[model samples]
Structures are given as structure tokens and as C-alpha cells.
Target: MFTRADLGKDERLDLMEFTLVLEHLGLSWTRAETQDRFEKADANLDGFISYAEYRAILEAQGWV
Candidate 1:
């Protein structure tokens, strides 16, 4: 799922790509909600979610 959203193929996801992942999951988050989730998943706050961060969030959310 993360791989599919990684349009840049940089092994990380930007805000837009993350949003698409949410959409793909049939989730409809407001901009603020999306940002908030992104911020939490981006443990380092480096403006991108690495695969480790992504998987961590999923595991934390009990979605994996």
C-alpha cells in the first residue's frame, strides 16, 4: 500500500502521496486530520514518511 502511494519512488511519502493512501483505504480525512496523522507518522518531522515510519504507524494503529 505504501509502495503504491510512493509516486516519487524515493522510499518515502510526501503529504500528497499519503493523502492518496488514505483515499485508497476508503478514508476521507479533512486536511487538518491528514496533516495531524502525517505529523505523527513522520517521527522525525523531516517532511516525509519513511517505510519504517509508515509501518510503525500502521502497527501502532493496529492496522497491520
Candidate 2:
């Protein structure tokens, strides 16, 4: 049911939205905790969350 519109203005995945998706998927984590999670997810360290990175985060959160 997910769609491209879930992404942010920059067309990148926003951490807040990502967090919500994780919650909906029955996973839990704090915003502060996700900071490092995001950093690790941003494989290229480009400061923007890529689709691959987002998927990785979800997997790491046990969402998939």
C-alpha cells in the first residue's frame, strides 16, 4: 500500500515518515535513537535518505 508520495519534498525519505512506517509495521524506536540508525542507513552519507537506505532501515527494524 505504500506509494512514492510517502517520500519528502526532496524526494528523499524523511526520517519522521520512516519512523511512522516502522511504528505501523509493529517496530518501535526513539527519534534520537533513529539518528544513528539513519546515519548507518545513509550508505553514501549524502545526508539524504535513499530508497535503498530506507528499505534497509525497514529491514533492520524488522519491518520486512
Candidate 3:
């Protein structure tokens, strides 16, 4: 999932790639909702979602 979501193939997900991840999960979050969640998921405040960060988010949301 991370690989697929990392459309840039840079080993991290930008906002656009993260949106693709939500779509892959069949989530229909509003743009604002996604942005909010994305901000929360970016633990390091690095402006991208690392694999560790993504996993943490999934765990927090009980999705993993």
C-alpha cells in the first residue's frame, strides 16, 4: 500500500499521493478531512508521510 501510494517512488507520500491511499481504502473523506488527517499523520511535520508514519496512523485508526 505504501509503495502504491508513493507514486513519486521517493519512499514517502505527498498530499496528492496520500489522497490516492484514501481512495485505495475506499474512503470518501472530504478534501478538508483528508488534509486534517494528513497533517495528523505526518508525525515529524516533514510534509510527507513516511512508511512508519503511515503505519502509525493505520494503527491509531484500527485499520491495521
Give me the runs in candidate 2 sitting further than 4 Å from their true place: 1-10, 58-64
Alpha-carbon lDDT, every model: 0.94, 0.67, 0.94
| RMSD in order of candidates | 0.7, 2.9, 0.7
TM-scores for all candidates: the values are: 0.94, 0.61, 0.95
Instruction: Compose the digit string of candidate 2's lDDT tens values, residues 6-60.
Output: 6555656666765665567665777787777767887988876767777776677
Report the poorest 10 consecutive residues by lDDT, candidate 1: 55-64
Q: What pairs collide in candidate 3? A: none
Full-model lDDT, candidate 3: 0.94
What would the per-residue lDDT of candidate 3 be over residues 1-64, giving only the tens digit for each residue? 9998787899999999999999999999999999999999999999999999999989988998
Ranking by TM-score: 3, 1, 2
Model 2, position 20: C-alpha lDDT score: 61
Best by TM-score: 3
